[model samples]
Target chain A: MTATDDRADAPAASIEDRALALLARTRRWHWAEAAFWLGAAASFALLPDSHLLLTEIAILGLFALSLDLILGYAGVVSLGHGAFFGLGAYVAGLTSIHLTAEPLTGLLLAGVAAGLLGALTAPLLLRRATDLTRLMVTLGVAMLLYEAANRMAWLTGGADGLQGVMIDPILGRFEFDLMGRTGYAYSLVVLFVLFLFARRVVTSPFGMSLRAIRGNSLRAATVGVPVGRRIIAIYTMAAVYAGIAGALLTQTTMFVSLDVVAFHRSADVLLVLVLGGIGYLYGGLVGALVFKLLQDGLSAITPQYWQFWIGLILVVLVLIGRDRVPALWRRAVRRGGAGA
Target chain B: MLTILIDGIAYGMLLFVLSVGLSVTMGLMNFVNLAHGAFALVGGYVTALLMNRAGVPFLATLPFAFLIPAALGAVLERTIYKPLYSRSHLDQVLFSIGLVFMTVAATDFLVGSEQQLIQLPTWLQGRFDLGGVAVGRYRLFLIVICALLVVGLQYVLSRTRFGSRLRAAVDDQRVARGLGIDVGTIFAVTFAVGSGLAGLGGALGVELLGMEPTFPLRFMVYFLIVVTIGGTDSLTGPFLAALIIGVADVAGKYYVPQVGAFLIYALMIVILVLRPQGLLARGR
Candidate 1:
């Protein structure tokens, strides 16, 4: 036998190569992603006037998306991201009450305040890769901020949170109605606009650098990524997103609570990200939808045992595996096609 | 002054008990078990349930309290943790956070949301006059138990085979495996032991701080600070760090009532800036 004939026994190299090539080609399917987002946005707009739940989902989706930016892309796991969110909410509430009646300006103030805080804390948090240490430090910063807000009751309205945040008409046209129609529209607009902005950011050179850092910080640093500075910038930007989301919630609801700063809130946001999948931007949106639906449905069914069910679901997710189920299904489908 | 010192010591010892397990897991397995506090909560709830609902004597329920959390820990390690041990820190953190939520929810479901009170047995109740200073006998008992546990742990870690295996595993798991040690079993056992210690701390601490649904998240920060400052692996590190924190916490509360609550965070930030490796660099 000739060398070529002998190499034919080398186990279908071309088949494997072809499969890998197909996978590589399908990996960058942006059209499918765009279609998915469009479908989600359309469905959201079509949802009836369920003001409280819809508004909450919108705001939380934004919050989760903010987290997705840093966590999914940048790989910075923050247990204190709520600090920015809460800070933004408080800032928005305070500004609307004390400074400007304009809801748009309130949102701007929130993002700016939260972004600045993120920038300040990023220096300290960016120094370590020890997840535990980072978790603790970020958590500590949040606690400190919470304590400060609690102590400065005179300014923050303390535990009562800022009340009577009168948000003026959006650009002197759309008034925030109590039925939540206006609120939902406002949040939807904000979410879509921010989503577009975030989408742009993720596709930018900065976003590429973030992904590079997340993949391999040491290698990225070696290749002139300025890993520390990138981390700080991403963290700060995430804070802005989170802050805006928080402000949106307050503006929509016209009230804010110290619960925004609570550790549970932070933990819940992280949970949402995990449930939806962290690396994908849509993960946040998906997680928020699933979590909020589960929470609302389960709580309505059994208020006392709702948490138990939630916990059980989480444990099952962890035990059964996060990514295996989908992968297995895909394989099964492919095999079925091959057989056909 | 003596009271403050004693109170601080007692509080610190309790913190040390709760945090050492977390420190070991973080140091050895490189896993951030957020559910560490959940184990403590489990111990507290079980003990409280038995003592109050089951009408079991407080002293008698001690073994049940300890064993329950230990078993739970083993199950958690085997089922949940084993798979995630090799995962990224962020994933582990998320997994543990899930565990925490589940534990809290389960506890709340099993036991009512109302805070459960644990009455010290008649023998352990009340005060003992300490040369003109009155100290609670239970506090003294805790002090004694803590001291013994610390000494015993130090001895085990320094002299025993399991200790050596644990150290080897922490240093390098592949190398330890090459040396023929059952690394998986060691990990499970270590996790159980650590969890057991947390339960003990929880059971004992119930009297000092009542058992409530919010205890896990509320006390989580304090525990994290202790473990973080103590450097996650060294037994003495948590002990010493807890003392410093406990004392500082008390003093801060007394002097600066406004920012008193944040003193620990300030301390944590300072430590992070100065010695990010923790006060006593986690096990070499």
Candidate 2:
């Protein structure tokens, strides 16, 4: 509000600011670690027969996390994240069929493919677009890809889906088993590693710049943040994450279908992320778990009306408050803050 | 070619009626309601259920389609949508999408997941051949009804005191309130009419678009395309945009039967990129 005092100067003041920033950045949030351990420990011990569901949850968590990167931190709204996810799955599926099936390499390749696609499309997408514009553009891109895949059935297997996807043993060591234990464990490891990487990124200086941009893009630009470039970079990075999530799904399931590229994937992930609460690092993970569990429990009871329940939840969530449900961990945070 | 044009016009007219109310709410109220499609679905189901089950005449069922949804919409607006006028677009999208999901599920549970058939009256069933081309009897009916609706809507929106007040309210809520315009009532009425139009469109379009539990999700893109591409401010923009889209969709399907809806989607992307404010929005 005070424009008269605006100045970036004095080496001593800048150094002191840097020191303060470093201390604030390095502050440890206990809940994130708590969530990781709780998910890893509880799922394995409790649901021995639910490896497949757990694996799916893990993959979805990662996908939701990717959405959080742009939507929560960078203020970029995309409605077609499933494009990268489907692309990653298909790319990884093709790689397994046509190249090596090393899990890490496939994931890496998927991430790169999605990232490259994001980089190429973003300039076109980000051009003079607002919320509604971005939403439509993202959706348009996804639909275009979907139609292309459907038409090129020989390559994408069309509606029949890309079949005969056989992945080799991870690191040529642990073989994928019938019970899906290996898939669950593999996905858990990937989730943990990526979660670590994301934690590091969000806690860094660049992440703070993203928050500033989200709060006020004009002010951020005035303060020397390259707004367009940063948005593009984060969008591309989110795409890579989504791609990797897709790659994980294909690897675990050994199948890639047109459904992977559908609008519901994007919508579902967004729902899960927001359900856990936007902007929090672990929101995606927590949302994925709760959403999957709800789906499982509700579907078992009223199989035909499961969607109705989900819809009811959404209406209630919106009506009551965005911060009310799914993010139960907030209580812990609040209680901790109060105690301190 | 002429048949495609006719078909496109009819189709586009249907899109306009279904979505114009949405345009009013979105443009004037500045609220994004993705649940607009659900109103259409409700209308379609109402028409189908009454006509098929109760032996009601199709014409008699049309009023129910429009009125029932309008009533429901009015109630919903007063209750849920009022508070969301100030929320972020993301929240609005989520809330509406959730409603859509519930509506879809509820419809599926109630009516079964099978496609609801609209048995049109014999008078509107057959094709009317003009020169060498055969235009659908039902499509002609659609064009007439939608055109009348458009004229009525345009007249009410542009020529009526209510219209000016509504527009004034949209331009500035506080100023309109200061002028003693009941903005809330205007919005509620508009929301009802919009939902009613969606119902009428749904009832009209069931045969063309196919009505299943997933109708809302499927034709959502088309409705959004019409609204977004047409621009936000005026009815003519969406009307013209809908016409072009209808023609494009019909032509695309006719010529490249294998390509399906790819052209329309691609065109939408191009239009959106070129004119983010919409094809007809005046520069701010």
lDDT of each: 0.81, 0.87
- Off by more than 4 A, model 1: A1-45, A324-340, B126-129, B282-284
lDDT per residue as tens, model 2, B122-202: 999889888989999999999999999999988988999999988897778899999999988999999999999999899
> Which tens-of-lDDT digit does each residue in A35-154 have in candidate 2?
566868678768879999999899999999999999999887877999999999999998888888777788999999999999988887567857778888888989888888888898
Residues A167-216, candidate 1: write the lDDT tens digits.
99999999988778788778878888898888777766677689889888
Please report the TM-score between candidate 1 and the true structure: 0.89
**Model 2 lDDT, residue B75, Cα:** 98
- Best candidate, lDDT-wise? 2
TM-score of 2: 0.94
